[model samples]
Target: MRKKYVIIKVFKMDERGVKLYQPDAQIKKGWLSLWRQMFSELIGSRELIWRLFVRDFLAKYKQAVFGVAWALIMPLVMVGVFVFLNRAGVINIGTTDIPYPAFALLGLSIWQVFATGLTACSNSIVAGGSMVVKINFAKESLVIASLAQALFDFLVRIGLLVVVFVILRVVPAWTTLLVPFALIPLLLFTLGLGLILSLLTALMRDIPHIVTLLTTFLLFLTPVLYPVPQGKLFAILNRYNPLSTLIIEIRNLVIVGRITEPLRFMIISLFCLFLFLVCWRIFHLVEPRMAERV
Candidate 1:
């Protein structure tokens, strides 16, 4: 009877009897493991991404008077300003092989993709705060949707570019067909920086303003209007500035049927790819905390 009365069960618990098997509040994870989980989650959320893109695409033009023409306005304005200045002798941009209008338009079109895409993605997380808080979805979807919108705008501008090409009677080389491939580095670099900027903007509202200011200044730093410079200082700058190489290469492919710096383009493309993966991982890891901040 005494031996039978001594039955006891042991349960795993903290000192206060809280279950030790409960899910961790935060887990330490290796970078590789985190990337695998992030990618898996993103793959599963592909439908959500497409839906979000459609929602954003429709919403963008739903009430706009000009519709997609708004995409044309910025590049047109920039081109107009510089063309006026050049014609008025306020500036002397060296002669371009193509018509000055077409040259500037081509460069602006490429630069706009990077500039607008970065701006859109950087603001996406904060802009979607209501949905982010209320819905269960991958936040990466917002960034991707914004990028898709930028791409849509880019495609629309391409139509205008064709008109410019036709008007100027500028017959691009066969390599012109390959010009689209040059967007690879621009997309990777923009997406990489955009992810990081989105998180920073979410935490600190001032980031968007800073980005706006910097973007305006960056145009001059990049060789969008003026030709790539010849001085040793500028030579070094152009060499290091990835946009310079990318834009120059695209122009060369279309106008000259050659790539200016093949090795540099390849190197920058790889660097951008690496940057995107790492920034995306950081974004994924920090995403759970975004709702609270925003």
Candidate 2:
């Protein structure tokens, strides 16, 4: 087998108005030049990302009658089932700091940002399809643009959250302002996993479907619809699951004005940042080959 190489040119200009040309190092060859290359492309392609984001955002709602309402509807339907079950005493979801409906809805809204972003970003390369083969650009743009749709849906669902709060007559804690800051780690973790998964989904077409299925299963395990269980088997799972801590910390901030485990939250946030950096580098290194796979 032969190795494939990409030649990168680094151009520097000195005071004499002469150009100096040097060869950039490959990351696979364990060099730092690729980092500069990737950052340059990512920063330079902001307009391209916005264009792609707008195209996808419009395409999603163009033919749909309900449009953004589906965002609120789906979460409401899911939470409604749990609300009914708890009311019927078929299962105890445990007491929430706010009403159960409010608590579950808030958790699911935050969770959907990760779940939807993961599924969307994983499919992004394949969804780019013809354009990816025909054009040359940073493939990261596709995954990043795909994430914008989920964020739009998340903003739309904020209306439902406000409605729930008004109806239940529950006032959120002042620390609710910190919810967005807490969510930064969750978003980073999702984008990191999604960046790697996007490449995989191109190689194996079924990966996106599997990702969707896994996210659905994880909903039951991650305490989106219930309070953290006490000393149960799941408490251990919650203790380590980054998503659980992210969602729970945000929720507690909304209701209690405090984070239950500030140290744990800080640790998970750092892990998320590390994971995102590693995954981003992996994506940048392999992106040239993605066109062939897709």
Model 1 misplacement above 4 A? 1-30
List, residue by residue over 1-294, the lDDT tens digit for candidate 2: 855544433334346857544444232543465567678889999999999999998888889999878888899999999899999999998778899999999999999999999999999998998988899788899999988888888889888999999999989999989888888898899899999999999899889779978999999899888888887788788877889999888889988899989999999999999999899988976666666668
Query: What tens-digit string does per-residue lDDT give for candidate 1 at 122-199?
Result: 999989868888886788889988888898898999899999999989998999888777788788889889988998
Best by TM-score: 2
Off by over 4 Å in 2: 1-30
Predictions in order: lDDT:
0.82, 0.86
Clashing pairs in 2: none
